[model samples]
Target: MTAIDQSAVETLFTNARTHNVWKDKSVSEQTLRELYHLMHFGPTSMNCQPLRVLFLNSQAAKERLKPALMPGNQEKTMKAPVVAVLGYDTEFHEHLPRMFAHNKDAKSLFEGKTDFINTTAFRNSSIQGGYFILAARSLGLDTGPMSGFNNAAVDEEFFPDGKVKSNFLCSLGYGDHSSLFPRQARFEFDEVCRIL
Candidate 1:
């Protein structure tokens, strides 16, 4: 098969930025569901799909999240159309046997090993979080991925369960062009990449 067009792929990668502001227009729940459906197809280690997304769009939910955010991020997160809480379930491996489609007793591996389970869960779920950013972009949405938050506070307010922990937060919306700064520069391929 012929390789995908380099320039076009480069455009998508280069042009995507962390949008901080958005117009007043709303994002439909259906659109969010579609995004999840598409991104779930992305691969994960051992088919252990641990990422759990919590979309906070309601006034009450956003209010609850306010205290957890850094002061700098609170305004943007609250103003954005939707704030996605990317989290991972420590119990993800419990369903791995079914997810793997035939690997019986997969749950046994993580049954009592809390440390190992947390490691795998966070690693794979972080991959899913990256998938979410690309998936949202593909659906004509702009994203602002942020980690400037109190994860422990967020988990207490939103997740509540110790098994599910927050990874990062991202604002999603139809971006406001008026709020964007000039695109920043990137290192040259030769400067950043080395061939053996």
Candidate 2:
């Protein structure tokens, strides 16, 4: 009904930055759970909530992910209190029977349609990933979302069964502003949008 205040807008959008460096503080498991609770409410087509997240917070897990990272992403990823491997489950439609109870045929709709299933899984999981970043920001955490890694390697390391695929990696924590580059310009609304 009503718009959120300017400070809330700033917290979630206008002033949010892609963090590279992080403060020494740690992100508690409770906070991480809360972040998921907040983002899970974001909508998806047919209620096909396909996104799966793996939070790499320990030294051993970070080590496992190191070889898959691009050189630029390694340091920041290792240093951040949490590195989230946001993935999409190819078998997401299997859950539709439970998630979309009113529509009994929802699961069957995607059962044998590989192309359609892939498209929906990727699209909706990506949308949820955006929600994840905003949810983290709303909770006073900063995020550095990067896609500069070997997807296959990440999948082999984290999702060995091949049912889930990595979409992107996001490093999260209290950001160190000193490491931020100057904000870049964005296209004006009129230039990027159409009202016809």
Candidate 3:
């Protein structure tokens, strides 16, 4: 495969910013669906796509999530065009038959293994969450992914069925660029990485 152009690279990574304040502009439903279609193709172990997203776009829906969010996250999340309640499915392995058809024994690997299931679900879904951010950026939308909220409260309020567990929340919309804080420092390759 060919390398993506630098412009696209900047769109997804280099110039992408995690927005806190959003503009009054709205994000279209069609764009949200397209975003999912693009991000779902990202790889997961055994192709178990465990990440389940709940998009809260209406005031009433956002209100339901209000109590779960920390004080600082409430205003920005409430005003953002979309707030995605990202979760991981506890029973995601049940779909392994269809997701990992090549391995007839795939389902058995996670079946009855509580610790294993939870770990796989959380790890793979978090990877998908990262893909979700890039996919939104590629679609020209701004993102704010944060974890300052209460997880238990979110799960009880949103995922009452007890199957999907709340992982994090991400706000999406047109950002108020002027309100952005200066970018923080990052570790250099030599500081955080090493060659064998």
Candidate 4:
């Protein structure tokens, strides 16, 4: 496959920033669906695509989510046009027969193994969340991924069934970059990576 143009690369990563301030623009339902359709193609180990998302767009939904947010996250999340409750399904293995057709034993491997199930679910879901952000950016949206929140409260409020668990919260919309904080420094590649 041909490499994507430099502008596309910049749109997805190089120039994308975590936006805490958003404009008054709303993210339509269609856009959210399209975003997920694109991000779902991102790979996961054993095809255990466990990440689940709840998009809070209405005022009532945001109010329900308010108590769960930490003070620092509350304001930005409340103002953003969309807040995605990124979650993972502990029972994701149940879908393995359909999702991992080649491996008939995939479901059996995770069904009785609590530790392995949790590890795989969390790891893969986290990777999918990264894909979600990039997918949103690719669609001309901005995202503010924040972890400063009460996970237990969020899980109870959003996924009370106990089947899914909250992973993180991401606020999405058109960003207001005029109020953005100065960009922070990142570690040099040599300091963070090694060629084997």
Could you report the Cα RMSD, in angstroms, for every candidate shown? 2.0, 0.7, 0.6, 0.7
Question: Could you estimate the TM-score for every candidate?
Answer: 0.91, 0.98, 0.99, 0.98
By TM-score: ranked, best first: 3, 2, 4, 1
Q: What Cα-based lDDT does every candidate model obtain?
A: 0.89, 0.95, 0.95, 0.93
Off by over 4 Å in 2: none
Misplaced by over 4 Å in model 3 are none
lDDT of 2 by residue, 1-196 (tens): 8999999999999999999989999999999999999999999999999999999999899999999999988887899889999999999999998999999989999989999998999999999999999999999999999999999999999999999999999999999998899999999999889998
Per-residue CA lDDT of model 1 for 85-172, tens digit only, reads: 9999989987887898677877887888989999999999999998899889888888999999999999999888687999999899
- Weakest ten-residue segment in model 2 by summed lDDT: 72-81
Candidate 2 positional error at 42, Å: 0.4
Candidate 4 per-residue C-alpha lDDT over 1-196 given as tens digits, one digit per residue, 9 for 90 to 100: 9999999999998999999988999999999999999999999998899999999999789999999888877888899999999999999999999999999898999878989988999999999999999999999999999888898998998889998999988999999989888889999999999999
lDDT of 2: 0.95
